[model samples]
Target: MFSLRARDAMSASWAVSLLSKSLTGFSFWIVGTGAASAHVKWFCAYDAAGQPRGLENVLCRDFELLLGVALLWFFSGCVVERTSLGELLVRSINRVTEGLRLHTEVMIRAVCGFFFISLWAVGGIILTPELKTTSPQVGLLQLAIAAGLLSRRTMPFSAAGIVVLFGLAVRDYGTFHLADYPIFLGLAAYLALTGLQKDLFGVPPLDVVRYATAVTLMWASVEKWAYPEWSFPLLIEHPGITLGFDNEFYMRAAGMVEFTLAFALAWTPLVRRVAAAMLLGMFISACFEFGWLDVIGHSGIIVVLVAILADDRPREAEYRAPWLAPAGLCAALTVTLFTYYVGHAAMFNTSIL
Candidate 1:
């Protein structure tokens, strides 16, 4: 009974609605399936019968906006150089540590011995599910490295032993999972460099410690995002830790905090030191919820973070304006996460969510 113009308008409205529905569905399918590929529960909207149907849930969240902010910050930082600002910031940090010097002899002993005890005590694959298995060989190799460190006569040779263990571990656990313990390699680098009086690239041992700490955090943070559902087991076992937030929101926010702080550790010396302290606190607190395995697994990085506190900024590291460092961090994270989502979505197709 409607006029031609009215019918035409109704048809147009229906078409738009249909297109909206299709796009929304496609987005959800792509994201949910892609996330599932990584064992993550980040993207999914349940249907009326308590079933997941599409991207409606993730679409409602500001996840994309968060990523967008990272990209924008990164590009903007490229426009500003920190020639003066960087020097000033560096000077301020240095002033705080003025006249504070850790005895190199004591530091090398503590750093090296810490690894020996932590690994020998645990005597396993980093105390995580991924590297759950261990062998007597790994323990014996660790002992050799520890002994060499104590004697100083065979320190470089023992350091090489650590590198050999790295090869064995990669063969056992695969590079993807064992990459979490870059601190092992870092410690090896320290032992080797100090044996040669920091001869390799004239890099300081503390620089290796800082870099190892940063890489460890960033690597673990990404795992949290990709396998967020892995934490649900902990949540169900210890419900009080949720702190009244929804599981998904808490996990996502936690990932953001971790990744942000990890990036900070690499970019700014002052901020990196602060971030290390905060992360050490977080890891310690998590022990109550996850127990001793968590402690042992994180032991290497925790020691490295402490080492960072005792040491000053590395001479070789490039200086950047305080703001630019954070901006570049944002960009790195944005690109990393986006690539993961898009790549997996394409690889797995639509059934994954």
Candidate 2:
């Protein structure tokens, strides 16, 4: 009897150890495919005005399953946010990021400066890789934007220049294509509001950037669901990113993860910081696969995420009700889905079904 009991215990222990290792390995694999988050249009053929897959196709069984899981995960995070554990985590993060917190603004400015200069260096690109331009003036405009970031007084001008560039991109590419990058407008808003020492309707500049980042990511995630085929070429080119899963299922899962993390950015302080940190890691890891374009294109968001991670300020009106966070998440998901499907259909003269 004693021998049998010991054997049973040893088997259980080994099983637990194997499970742990498997999960760890799986996580590393997921992180390594961080380039999966890159703008697919940059690497594949995409028509902004083309009709995306129908809502019925996108919201299939796999998507529903993922949505349920994401809801549970988000609700659990909200519950945790109310506990002492959340407070402790926030305190620890604040303590470790003390230096970063102090220089967040300067760091953001410097990074944006570098990003604009890189864009100028690579000219013929309107904001991102796919938005090509033949005009020499765009490069000069980017150079001016970079130069504006040199002084607090001139940062607003830089912000204006960013807006102008975005407008030009929209003019050339259309609203659907430009929708992939609201983060630029967020950066522009951040620079303008901070430089002018003003706030929009009482919201702080950094918060504006945070909200914009969340929206940008959420919107991008919707694209993955609506047009998973757009990324098929990328997967075909780099098969290793699938991690043994069917390519279609992998894209859906990727969209779920991105949407969930992006939604968490608007949650409690601890949750947002952790989400930002994870996203920052993903972006950095993606650079290894994508090289300079990923680095420069992601530089602005990386800086924003860093600032978010380092932010230690107390939020006066965070979601205190246990149910509010989950409700907000659901509402956000619904809105983005409706807008993407309905809005796209309307804009492109296609049916949502």
Instruction: Pick the lDDT winner.
Output: 2
Candidate 1, residue 46: CA error in Å? 24
- Best-performing candidate as measured by TM-score: 2
Q: Write the per-residue lDDT of candidate 2 for residues 1-353, one digit (tens) a residue.
A: 99999999999997885565445334533463486778787778877778888888988766766676667666777788768998888888989889999998899999998988888887789798888999999999999999999899999999999999999999998887788899999999999999999998998899999999999999999999888899998888778877766688778877877888898887778788988888887788778777888888889889999999999888758756767776888899999999988878878898898
Q: What's the TM-score of each model vs. the native?
A: 0.66, 0.90
Please give the distance, in angstroms, between residue 331's alpha carbon in candidate 1 and its true position after superposition.
2.5
What's the lDDT for all of these models?
A: 0.56, 0.84
Model 1, C-alpha of 37: deviation from truth (Å): 23
lDDT tens string, model 1, 36-89? 111122122211112222334433344444344433433343333245664565
